[model samples]
Target: MADSGQALARRLRQLRQQQWPDTTVRQPQLARALNVSVPLISSWENESTPKVPPVSRLQTYALIFCTRRSIDGDQLVPLDETELTTEESRLRDKLLHELLDLRTVALSRTPAPGSAPANPWQFDDGNRIVIVCARLPDELLTRMPYVRPEDPDYIELYTYADLDSLFELHGHIRAFNPGGEVRRRTAKELEPDDLTSHLVLLGGVDWNDLTSDVFQVLDLPVRQVNDWGGDEGPYFSHGDRRFSPQLADGRLREDVALFYRGPNPYNARRTLTICNGMYGRGTLGVVRALTDSNFRDRNTAWLHERFGAEEAYALLSKVRVVRGQVITPDWTLDGLRLVEWPD
Candidate 1:
């Protein structure tokens, strides 16, 4: 007798054949239709005992299949409740526990930080506050206040001031140097405009050796959220631009040079190095050489032709080279210059 998995697989194949009698359904097309990965469908086809999909995903698959069949306006018709219950029982008893065990083992293999106390927001007293804009990590989420994506409280704030300050605080929390100075300057800049508004710091900060000066410098009265702990949603990579740190072997250094050189090198050489020399080291020099005024201007036309303004902006933000120093453009460049060779 064929096992349940084989039966399910045969049934699925039959359903597909009945639905699309003339056409051969490809794995990718089926995966898309089912809202699942191609590997999953492949597994179902090959495995002796195929794992049943989660209830939510199964519902989606049923809906998609039903819609394709043009039955009941996008609703799955003729679903046997008894069959579903039996499958669900098998999945819960046989598959779920095993899958969960594997997942637990995988999670356990990774290094994790100390657990925060339950209810991190209990410290918030409507005084100093930090609002987090990024997704929170699961480990950190247990400590904080987080409304779900569909919740009415879910709000995405992206004003320059909010983002700038949030980014600055994020730097402080992550010990991001450039972000620290940016945070300080941001606090100073915003203080005058919003004096009455209590300082609300969002995102994590390094608590070790943290002094009142750090808080005072940023004008204290801050609220903080460390979403790195995982209370937030998924991490989204919105831009196509990629960033690679310069490795000591100098191969990565050459990579940076190639990016700057592009199609024409000699004609595009107007360079303005923006470095927090104390923090950024020599990476800014590399970026300046690559994105100098001449290169920027030339690239502008190319970028316009290739991508829209929003895309360009996203690319630029993603191209950022983060460093340890906290120097600004107004400061002298000598501090940040790498070893100078004899001219």
Candidate 2:
């Protein structure tokens, strides 16, 4: 967020300086096209201390830069937006919209200086947080009913295997951290910027590649075994003991979940948290520990007390299911915590 202003300045300078190899657009030429003084243009381009230009000028800059006539001859020509062809209009709109977004961020980049607006899920810096979700395998999705376009139900999120966990975590994070930005991405669609911001990976190693990737680099004491179709079911292996789900009557009765928090290995300044379980119910259990209205306050407080300001910690807990509904696990309760870091 601190670089928002510099990003706007860099883009504007790139547009003016990179059009031609030998010649850069002089400030005077841009001033003539924008109908502004050269000194004002210089202020906008000054790298050491850049000034954000007005929106009207940004609109004209988009129009002129997208048009060939602006640089066809010897000078920058003023071109009206109405004169642009379809493709030119498309280009101009994209540039203008990007500039406007940058302007908004640069103008209000600084919020309260501390963690007043931040929750455990949100960052103190008020940066973006992306929740990466696991997508069902194509083979499984291809067989699920009601997913076909021709089907009457035609559920759009049928491909999402962890819908219950996604809905619970996404809404809960947004509600508690209203001042920060929150976004969602399927594992495959993760943007480059997402790796640098605060990230929350949902589901376990078998389905979520992001979770698998993080576990590979992070030095956590626990691991989620992903031996699908093996003799042993999925479980959380911590040191010497294996914590697997308890099944009765061919239905899950209790599940094992791992919740981890630490600074992101990719970007030390940002935080990385993973909520994973052997099954969806397990995932829901750990997420609701800090999001459930009845227990969130107590659960969150316990985490702060247990972990204190530690840079990293992992908690593996047992999630109980009562008549097919997942009951949120309280870390404070005895017998709920199976294993934990900093023990």
TM-score of each: 0.20, 0.63
C-alpha lDDT (0 to 100) for residue 294 of candidate 2: 61
**Candidate 1 segments exceeding 4 Å error:** 69-343
Best by TM-score: 2
Q: What overall lDDT goes with each candidate model?
A: 0.31, 0.79
TM-score of 1: 0.20
lDDT of 1 by residue, 75-121 (tens): 33434334345544444334323322222222223313542111111
Model 1: lowest-lDDT 10 consecutive positions: 257-266
Q: Per-residue CA lDDT of candidate 2, range 58-146, in tens?
A: 77888877766668566888666668899988988777767766665565563334412223664557788888888789899887898
Checking candidate 2 for backbone clashes, the offending pairs are none
